[model samples]
Target chain A: MRRLCVHTITTKPLSLEECLVEFPKRGVSGITIWRQALEGRDLGAVARQTREAGLDVVSLCRGGFFPAATATGRQAAIDDNLKAIEQAHAIGAPLIVLVCGAVPGQPLVESRKQITDGIAAVLPAAEKAGVKLAIEPLHPMYADDRSAVNTMRQAHEICDALGSPKSVGIAVDVYHVWWDPELKEQIDHAGKTGRLHAFHICDWRTPTIDLLNDRGLMGEGCINIREISDWVDATGFTGHREVEIFSNRLWSGDQREFLEKIAASYAQLYA
Target chain B: MRRLCVHTITTKPLSLEECLVEFPKRGVSGITIWRQALEGRDLGAVARQTREAGLDVVSLCRGGFFPAATATGRQAAIDDNLKAIEQAHAIGAPLIVLVCGAVPGQPLVESRKQITDGIAAVLPAAEKAGVKLAIEPLHPMYADDRSAVNTMRQAHEICDALGSPKSVGIAVDVYHVWWDPELKEQIDHAGKTGRLHAFHICDWRTPTIDLLNDRGLMGEGCINIREISDWVDATGFTGHREVEIFSNRLWSGDQREFLEKIAASYAQLYA
Candidate 1:
């Protein structure tokens, strides 16, 4: 129960303060905050409020969109990532999940090179801030525009290319990697190399309506979340199992009910 | 132009007879007939009509849904595949493209095994009919309900598991596999093994609206179609560059104009 974390975006309708109030009541002990939830708020006060509510600030929701067509754009992305590091530090988040970016018409290999360079550019700031960057390898469906890093192997390659810095690791999100045949092996490799930093839980619905926001609740879809969670646990990953769902169907409903459902599902999953 | 092939479902509004007429007029020299198009049609007559219209019957659109929870369901899939082989033979099609199925909540490995066994079960019939089975590894997004076989590597593994039969090869659909990092290497391996049976061409739209029917025509989206086609060609795969778009947006339009746009896009892609 202590390990159960919910991303702020999971309950998008709720304010950060409301989440602080509601989540702990629902037995959610940890939280991964989306950047959106931090808008117009004092980071220090938000951090204090979250701690006062007895919630661990697990990680910042995202910090990467590193690929861009222009040199200026790439540099801007790097600057933004550095800002994210500052934000993570201010909010007392120990980690930041990166959704490495891709350009639509650009070659993926090129985008990947840019991603590596971008990460390298920002690694110093992240390290100085005492924040770790967990590269969340996005689903291949997002390879066109959302991310160039779409596999655990690719994420590992970026880490290797960046000289295997201890500050950089991977966030294993089941929504992105469950379909991968090499998932178990990759999880093992990430563990062996001490790069397994975070674990995310979500289900993939059949007849997925929207490419971006149609994720199902834990028991509502076909993903073997428990098996994947076991594999993550087998890696000695004592990290928060972050519930990060982006579902229009779920978001449009009662957020309190959604939180209750998430808690129930999490209980059944671990039980 | 000689190598341009269109799938019947790409122009869903048209009948088999209408496709035989319209496709040739649009300079589409080859046609991959979907099973739906063959419904209620005389196979011999359809074959004759296709040939008489000067359109080559390149292959059958699809014939695999092997994974089932029950043995009866699995046997039914095998039986349907056998029927597809018969249909392919009757229509003078030399190959059949397989969208290998997946069962939701079933272990992918188990589904893959069923897919292998299903292919093996129907292989002798396919061979007897001189019809090659092209295992089209669907995109990972389809890994839940569409296919457990979600990469060229998995497709190759299945082919290898089946003793690397010449009758069982692979269908390289750009829409399904363009995101794979090992795509080039896998295609080369398939070529070296004489398992490069088919080359499917379609673009992947950035905001792909529907999981099943939102495929873009060549040059309309982000896929590196020409580059992937070059990879296929490098493998000595001088097979038809089959156009297999499944777009609700396209289907609802005036199909004649859509065919013209496809022709234009194909010309630009090759030119």
Candidate 2:
């Protein structure tokens, strides 16, 4: 149906209660909440409030940060991700997005193996919990310190190695992948394998200020959001186009005004 | 033979004369001078100075930036590139690096086609002038404003389509391509196909402040420079490992101190 979702991370200053109340008012059909917002908050209340708002939980905002210098540290990450899967389940989210962690003062080759093994270890619990693990391949700039899984093909390779379509898939975020030469082909491949579980929307701004928090609004950057939307639509998987701009500029703005602007921009650039 | 080259852009504040004097003192064997530096300067004198210093002009700074909004604009770009190729020949550079221009307020798909056409339009002239056009695929972050070519695979595909090893090849830069999932495989592919023309070295800082000027010195950032150097070596590429940092911090330091630090870092991390 080409539904639109608002990722609450875009409005980092907003409370979960405020987000639940605001999304429907702005015509968003779904919400993708960050794990940081969920922490220490009442899960039952969050789940009940989200359901009461009649919003779809497209995805829970992340589960993987797998690399570690020690085995205990790595095991702790896996344990934490297991808990994150449970939270996703309780909140009725279909997918728990995994941002594969990067090397800790080590080479990329060694880190890549850690990421694959970490995902393999978590796949069993994810299947049992009935939560699809969505590998969100971050931009390559984050390949060292953030996510080692920096390409769609790499994410899909991990999924294939794990051998569980029901338990593993990928979240395609335009901000992270718009520069990829193999983007269209990879998206098409994901569609053929039914591995495209989520579609995230955000723009990559020129003269980008901050590597982590300077994501632009949809129409403000050079990304062809509508064209990407069309490609995702052609996949025949009618899911929400989740707005996930991690901008300090937007976070400092009025939450209601920001969501309104996002809705307006989405309609203008992507509708 | 393993050699060291100084990308004059790294010390852009210094004049070509200053660069020529510094190179031999710093134990550098080669230089890649920018077109702007050669624009008004006596290129014949500069070439003679390079030869007297026993310096190899590995590559000319650039020639590509071809996409334009009008036919005249496009033609002007081609003309500029022709002049650039002439300058490259005068300086005894084996390659004229090309940063394929981006879309002019258009979608990337359209911009990508323009880049292809632009390269094709200039190839014959470049070949006639005896200059190898090495496409430097910038990081995707620059895809919107700086360059449309963002991957080695994309650059190689362009070369393949153009069908001329004499006219087209790739300039592999670690700062741009270190994050690529297929980096190792693509480097191997590029080496095997003899499309590897130039290799530039730099590091990607974790909290990249400014998109254009915040590059880290080698070993200061997380890039596995040695591994990439090994890969480049395995390709039978005996070209210079040209240091091409764009750091505001380094640029602000004493030129001798900066060069010494770079030499020390190169020896410690990549030697």
* RMSD values, in order shown: 0.7, 2.0
- Among all windows of 10 consecutive residues in model 2 chain A, the one with the lowest summed lDDT is A103-112
Q: TM-scores for all candidates?
A: 0.99, 0.95
- The iRMS of model 1 comes to 0.7
Candidate 2 wrongly placed segments (more than 4 Å):
none
What are the TM values for chain B, all candidates? Answer: 0.99, 0.96
User: Which candidate number maximizes DockQ?
Assistant: 1
Candidate 1, residues A1-271: lDDT per residue as tens digits?
A: 9899999999999999999999999999999999999999999999999999999999997889999999999999999999999999999999999999999989999999999999999999999999999999999999999999999999999999999999999999999999999999999999999999999999999889999999999998999999999999998999899999999999999999999999999999999
lDDT per residue as tens, model 2, B22-94: 8778788889998877867887888899999878998998888888878898888888888888888888887
What docking tier does model 1 reach? high
Task: State the displacement of the C-alpha of residue A238, model 1, in Å, after optimal TM-score superposition.
Answer: 0.8
Model 1, global lDDT? 0.94
True contacts kept of each: 0.76, 0.44
Error of 1 at A194 (Å): 1.0
